[model samples]
Target chain A: MFDDRSPIYQQIANGIKDEVLSGTLKEDEQIMSTNQYAAFYRINPATAAKGFAQLVDEGVLYKKRGIGMFVSPDARGRLRAQRRERFFADVVDPMLTEARMVGVGVDEIVAYLKDGAR
Target chain B: MISLRDLTVRYGDTVAVDGITLDLEPNKIYGLLGRNGSGKTSLLSVLASYRRPCAGTVTIDGVDPFENAALMRATAFVRDSLDVTDQDRIAKVLDFAGRLRPTWDAGYAEHLADVFELDRRRRVSALSRGQRSSLGVVLGLAARAPLTILDEVYLGMDAGARAAFYRELLADYLAHPRTIILSTHLIEEVAGLFEQVIVIDRGRLLLHEDTDTFRARGVAVTGPAAAVEAFAAGRTVLGEQSLGGVRQVTLYGALADHEAEAARTAGLTLAPVGVQDLFVHLTAVGDTARTEALR
Candidate 1:
């Protein structure tokens, strides 16, 4: 859920992203309030709010003034797009680095990713 | 800026701050968070010019706070106790502050008194512990010092009051930015208010980092003991607990997506580590290690 090297808000953002991507969350669905998330997770509401705000900023969520944060209509797509953009930088680089160390070439790495996708 | 170089304080047999060096800048609200007996009060005392650091140098804007009248005048230190004599009435203390603090706004202080329903003529000695805490908060805010240090000033306040205080503190800080160092045990509650945070554990600096950077630093993994151990190999495991094959470990590092995926593939459940839990893991490990971390 968290690490000494990643911001808490980012972890929260990732958690919410998981829900959205998994279809547990829905388009235009009102997500839990900051206080609700905070109480449920036993974290500071501010921390939760920051996470929600980050999602809002990224267009994965939107605020309904005085109501609560709601998953955007295109939330899943938005997150998928953002994550896809960073996938290579975040995922592929390390994979390639690790693969190269083990004498696994680009073709083998590509084959493994293809297998995983299937 | 507030600077403490090799600061040390001793009270009888107790050594408070032991060779600490910290440079804190202005215009940011910092949470000077630590456990009890961590010398937070003593460090703030020296910074606020309320007490002299036994050894080392403490300077605010190039002036040693100890007995430095002008520097002390610009600083406000609010502890549960601010050395206000029991003989004085709460009103007198407010009145004294109103006169003494160059930035003191009497109207605002009176307004705070009204908000807290603090009776002016009531003796400070007769006040309840809760009320005393309220008074301390009142004085701290009303003083309006450039460097305002609140040392456990939220102790006696109820939940609602504490929430109100946080909101007002934030609002006030937003409106009139100043250097505020809040020393408290409520890490999660007030962690948001901090731009930069310094955690002193048992008279040592365990952590001093931007709130974002600090939060960016650790994670917990739960899984079978073998896989968990394997995943945690070459990583700093802050804490580990195992029951039969079920293992839970808190690791210190920036967890990347591949790392999380790796942990998942290795049959581990990734979880976020709480700052309080991290502090416990880091400090409870031992005095020697933590002390070295502080220096």
Candidate 2:
């Protein structure tokens, strides 16, 4: 559903981000070439290129010039940093706000995470 | 603003655009995506002032475009058929467009001809499909109309030519920006060109959204069947399939925090949906989020 509403490259960038966060892709790993990614995703090579550029901008991935994009040396760290930066407003804050409405306690959540971890 | 207001177009009894109402802003490229015979052409024709709608109005900047001479002059339609004289040569087409189109650029057209290796003396009807499309491109770019409409402008161009077209399009657009509406089947190739997208399915307005918001509208969640189902609960499911032990459900709507975290906890893949993926699913899908089923 490529539409005229927004540039497709932005979407391609987000797709790569999702792949990274999901661990389907690993840090310091080689990503597919532009042509390979395009054929695999059935996307335009230009769109894929734009996506890689976006990742490079976010420090999630970096280009090694003639080779291809590789998950950055600090890709996981960078992603974790970005996600952590947004955690309060995006996840923790929203979840807390919603939990308060349902009368759930912050202690309960922390305890749950601690237990969930174990 | 460009408006297609409750427009209905027909060819005798075959209804084209059933009734579409859209408000498009100025100075942007719009991608019109849909299946074959899905009324993308008819709707755009009305919008571009080429064909009048049967039941409603299409307006550019405020005036109805039907038979509106001023709008037609300001709007350039560079489709496969733009009513060229049968005997007119390729040079004549350029000359004609140069003379009639409000923003005609003769020098630019000549430059395009040189770039495409097109012979100025070659007649229009005698050209190949690729050449004809290039001619249309040349006309479209040089016309510089405020609103330029192209319906499948490149149907037969080879790979190299298509690449050339893309580069030229981007270069021209950057240098001389204008409102351009493109109707095409090659979604992925041109999706990046659009600033906005309008999807028309069987004459109905499926969606009109910014490229970013549209791309983030859905995601594919894949993993063990039960885990996927648990993670996907209450989401707008676009399409679904599964093996004996695993499933992948394409979900619509923005992915909230809880959902993302839950998916991670459950070990499900959360994939972002692309424009091509959305178009295919919407055109070929029959899902719960659909507004009206096109019969």
Best-matching candidate per lDDT = 1
lDDT of 2 by residue, B1-295 (tens): 9877789988988888988898988877788888888898888777776666789777777888768777778888877765677578888878777777768989988988888879988887788889888888888888888888888888888887877777777666656767888888777777666667788787788888865567777788889998988877766577889988989998877787897987887888888777688778777644424546322
Against the true structure, candidate 2 reaches a TM-score of: 0.71
Per-residue lDDT for B1-295 in model 1, tens only?
A: 8788989999998888888898998777888877888889888878877777889998777777778778778888888776698889998999888877789978878877777778999999998877888889889988888888899988778887787677667666655678888898787676666777898876777778877766656688999888888898888777788888899988876788998988888878988777667667666635565346334
Docking class of 1: incorrect
Q: What is the lDDT of candidate 2?
A: 0.78
- How many angstroms is residue B192 displaced in model 2 relative to the true structure, after the best TM-score fit? 1.2
DockQ for each model:
0.15, 0.09
The runs of at least 3 residues in candidate 1 whose Cα sits more than 4 Å from the true structure, single-residue gaps closed, are: A1-118, B285-287, B290-295
lDDT at B198 for candidate 2?
Answer: 85
lDDT of 1 by residue, A9-99 (tens): 7889989899999999999999888756765554445567778888888888998889878899988997888789999999989888898
Q: Write the per-residue lDDT of candidate 2 for residues A1-118, one digit (tens) a residue.
A: 4444344577677777777888888988999886566555544454567678888888888888788889887777777778889988998887987999999998999999999999
